[model samples]
Target: MNDPYDNCMAACDACAHAYDACTAAYLAERDAQALADCIALDIECAQLCRFASGAMARRSVLTPSVCALCAQACDLCAAECQRHAHDHCRRCALACEACAAMCRAVA
Candidate 1:
């Protein structure tokens, strides 16, 4: 069955993955000290996206609220990622932007 929130859930999941991958890329080779804010935001955004996805999957009452926050987090992550020149960051930014739009639709 196709759930009404399936698209939002997928977007949230993909956003979380993108943020995680971006963070991993930063930790692996990027200068952690210089990009500390980006790293922190990525972690927060990833967690929020995951939580939002779970809420939707479970059909929680707080899904709207969770998705709203997740959208904000995605926006923040996208802005931070856009500030960087790395390929991972660029990709993550795109993912984040897409996720935010999906989340807003549900919110």
Candidate 2:
């Protein structure tokens, strides 16, 4: 995918990895409300990171705008995940923070 985003690739990987972790947590925790919320945010952040990474990869004109939105989402998702103490939540928060930082760099 055009080598992905040099600046965003790590964040993209983090988001993707966090999504998997969130899914596993959802399955393990089974707390419909909180886990579901975390899972939903994880999925959203992952998808956005993927899209933003792809956009950056293609050097699209819309990348800046996309990155802006990515930063926002990642920030919110990170905050949400950080509210909990679970390992998965902590990992997700870290990933989101990384993604947010990358997005901010290019936004």
Give the TM-score of each candidate: 0.95, 0.86
lDDT of 2 by residue, 1-107 (tens): 44436858667766877877776767777566657776787788888888888888788999999999999998999899888888888888888888898888888
Clashing pairs in 1: none
Pairs of residues clashing in candidate 2: none
Model 2: runs farther than 4 Å from truth? 1-4
In lDDT terms, which candidate is top?
1
lDDT for each residue of candidate 1 in 20-96, tens digit (9 for 90 to 100): 99988898874688888889999999999999999998999999999999999899889889988999999999999
